[model samples]
Target: MRKLLGIIFLLYGYPAFAQADTTQYRVAGRKNLPENYGRPYVILISADGFRYDYATKYNAVNLLKLSAGGVASKGMIPSYPSNTFPNHYTLVTGMYPSTHGLVDNSFYDPHRDATYNMGNKAMVNDSSWYGGLPLWGLAEKNGLVSASLFWVASESRVAGIPPTYHYKYHNEFSNDRKVEIVKEWLQLPEAERPHLITLYFPEVDSQGHYYGPDARETEAAVHQVDEAIGKLVAEVSKLGLPDVNFVFVSDHGMLLSDVDHPIPVPELVSNRKFVVINSYSLVRIHALNPEQVRPVYRQLKKERNKDYKVYLTRHFPKRLHFRTNADDRIGDILLVPRAPKVFGSNPPSKRKYPGAHGYDPKKVPEMKATFMAWGPAFKPGKVIGTFENIHVYPLVAKILDLPVTHLIDGRSKVLGKTLKSP
Candidate 1:
């Protein structure tokens, strides 16, 4: 009986247990806050593609100091397809890619009959493609000011409200410039200052893609970002805001890819009519004709070997927590390559860069990202085990004392362990 109850709780979160306080942590409801509520200031920072090991391996002085003084996790596992936009959106919305409607960095949306690409400014700014209310939107609705420095989907208005302040994403911006912008937002007057802010730095991910995860260029990039973080921390400390919190996270980590071992997609699918969306390690196949589904599935299944795993969306593994919705926007079939390997239509050039991600997070340790919290609200000098990235949303919501507006998959108890007692 005890074992069965444990399984139930694991599947349904604390709500499944009779003794749990469902009212305080209700997953869906309107929450009203007092006109002058006292909420801690929170700053969420994302260092894109900074792997779990990079925190210690690359001599990142700022991250190391933060980890030592506050709560740090072994790693933060990203949602399946473990790409940038999907996982970053998952962090803020507490929903999987299927639930949030940003299934990939780039994907075709059948409902809108449009293609949403990360690089296309107009499509990125379109609010129709976004499904869940992001953290900034939730904060704004609850009367708290929020600002964003290039978080995915932050530029778009959700529920008819954008962040109180946000900047258009520009990759050319230096890490120091991004940090300076966050500092400026923090320097506003008490009434005008944002209670929640998000900052992103993409240098590490860029270097990792161009020079592999272990290369000296990646290490240099990590150090550069770390210096910027140190400067930001100093600026925030100067403000001396009481009960300020900092949550450092990453979208997903990178894996060392071998240019020599490319799994050709043509070998797995003989049919030429399918639309293949390939992201190196993960491949999504959408059949143009309904008749081609079975044959495509059969061909891919037969080709599955030590190098890759294939699954029909309906039969996707339960552990991934993906393909939950009927109109998930995923392809008819999904292909995930084994670690250090990639799936592509053509063989990679010998000169091609040698690192990638978007593999199953459970299988690749290198693909695991970092999560660390430092603030008055968090416990000091505590190190916890790995957790899913979705849980970050509820943690932030709890700190800001706002009610979640939708039914999200994240569990408060999973992340509540990192916080100090109220």
Candidate 2:
């Protein structure tokens, strides 16, 4: 038992064995922020399910200006399957959905032996279920106050303290109210100011799911949200906080789903071929009653590719690094469709509208989302070739000057390049 415990300790880092003993992890500077006095405040905004083309397609002039004048990726690659809960968690934790244990928007927790849905605050807010520290938690730990507006996992406690300010989950809040609240917080005095602030817009994703990705209503919602964003930016510019930074990014881009079709899960389940845990456009399947796991996995892969493709959990695509650890709660098989369809226990159903995002993050050329950053430390008009969602956490840590031990999935270089060196 001691030997096994030692290995677990080594894998988790010897320091973690100390197990979150204090409110302060470590502080770097006088203000407990990165060395540069001119380091700007960062506002990470998420336009859930907004496609990359929305700027040009919908004429989002304010967003376009930021993209053109500051760093923006051609496409920001998301965690595998590209679901909302996992992707949002990844942005702050710097860990993939697999590593972080949020495999999909919904899944069954074998340990609790119950269904865990992403929208359920009771389930998602439990710190025991979360594997990594979120950006706000890290900031607050190092003496910086942090705030969030309707972000997934924000309700979860960090260092035993809640965000300095936050809103409970509520789908009813209007976009205008969201802007008003963020603007109010930004107006707070510097001493009482939140060093990290996150704002989420759910309309784009909501509309896309009921309609196709390019649905007229979805386009309209994108425009509306952009206008809201414009208002916030205008307000921020007027406040004049020295070196404040603004980062605009999306969890994952949207994809068009058939309004009339859903994939069948019973066919695979009845045959004892696979177990359906949860699904969207992408499905997670565990090998049921494995007689020979590899051979069955191979056959499952072949059968799926006729309409969709499957990757053994251990053999996921290299770029994602999603399936890196066997204990990451990944399924034995992962299924992704080339077309727009979701698999569920019931047969295909029809509605007037349908859209989805759990498709491969790399698929759907237009599925890529946009990112933009502008402020004191970042170079104006500088462009980066590629960026990942996980990079955001490190960037947050760097700007706040919080000391973190883990190297995380992303690099400081991606965000560091934007800053003027000390």
Candidate 3:
């Protein structure tokens, strides 16, 4: 990894942060913001657990409109585990789960000496808990106002600065309210305008978790959210904001799971019980009782169960690139399920549905999501084909002419291959 970083540095010049100071940071896509021009806003909307197939099946017209008329990828290639926060952070920072430091949906925060879950805004939004900067923070530093509707960690004060307008997590509200708030934020005047904006809808993911990936419930949730997206786009288009862009994407796809797929660790090792933890990429187990450690370790090594695969901390696959040092955020022992199987929070009797991610990155569909963009600044009806999530940050940077930062793991490419370069 050190060697790779050295090579990257040699090829790309210094990391974007190597040259700057206290000037409010500006992200790469907002250089068009002017005293006279309204801020060049980019609206990023994440439809959680929304599959590409469902998008068309449910007639997500707004999404398809953006994809058909703008630069859209066939789909996005996500980092492993494909859970929410890790993938969301990946979208904003352009780094994989391993590099950006938010490896899973849940993990023990050693610095604070507490367990943090992605669903808890208080824990996930704490700036100290995060290692990378979201695009809004960079925009704020560079003298542009930014806002977030539901993106996690958007509430934190990065480098002691917060977005000009922000609403903390409020999942209880109706989708109408979420749309209203976003419309209001977009309606702000030039001086008060948010140069960058982000929003998320977890209803689909919630449904997918409760009722397998292809369930009618999940499809309804997808359609409901698609209507909300349509509303947002219609509102934005009405505003006549110039040089605007909208990035529509999902964190990752979901996989169906069943109780029959459980690989019983306890059965493998006598008298040892593992503490299974919730995370985005890897299934982590902590040995609560020291006496159980050896038995559990032996069971994990000797067992050849088929539902999921276990790996010693040191031997986790090369693609995940998980840092397993004692102090690292991942767990002592990692478990990853094979395709179509998932890790559940609760045991089977009460388990209602089957769907999980955090699988191997090499898992074809699990690692692929979606990315589409449309705006006056971006070329229309273009297809960038498949792309890694990390490239998003650098592409945004290049579009905005902002100084690049080392925290990013993405690179820029000609996103609009079908349209003439402006």
The prediction achieving the highest lDDT against the true structure is 1
lDDT of 1 by residue, 213-267 (tens): 9999889989988898889888889987887899999989998887676877765
**In each prediction, how many residue pairs overlap at the backbone (N, C-alpha, C within less than 3 A)?**
0, 3, 15
Looking at model 3, report the run of 10 residues with the lowest lDDT sum: 16-25
Q: Whole-model lDDT for model 3 versus the true structure? A: 0.66
Give a tens-digit lDDT track for model 3, residues 1-422: 23323332332222422332212222334332465244456788888777645677667776787678887776777775577778888888877777777777777644455776664546756777676777877776677777777676777775565666766654444678777777776676666667678888877766766676778878888888878877877876787767777788888877775545554433433233545664423567665555765667677767766766777666777666674533466766777766665554333344344656656545656446778787776777777767677777766655555566655567665342533465
- Please, what is the whole-model Cα lDDT of each candidate in the order they appear? 0.79, 0.68, 0.66
- Once superposed on the true structure, which residue ranges of model 2 sit more than 4 Å away at CA? 1-39, 158-161, 259-261, 270-275, 287-305, 324-328, 344-347, 350-352
All candidates' TM-scores?
0.88, 0.84, 0.82
Stretches of candidate 1 off by over 4 Å are 1-37, 267-272, 304-306, 345-351
Deviation in Å, model 3, residue 227 alpha carbon: 1.7
Q: Give one digit per residue, the lDDT tens place, for model 2 in 26-110.
A: 1222232333333346788998888767777888888888666666666787777687788888988888877777767776554
Deviating ranges (above 4 Å) for candidate 3? 1-39, 110-112, 267-281, 286-298, 324-327, 344-349, 414-422
TM-score for candidate 2: 0.84
**Of 2 and 3, which scores higher on lDDT?**
2
Candidate 1 vs candidate 3, TM-score winner: 1
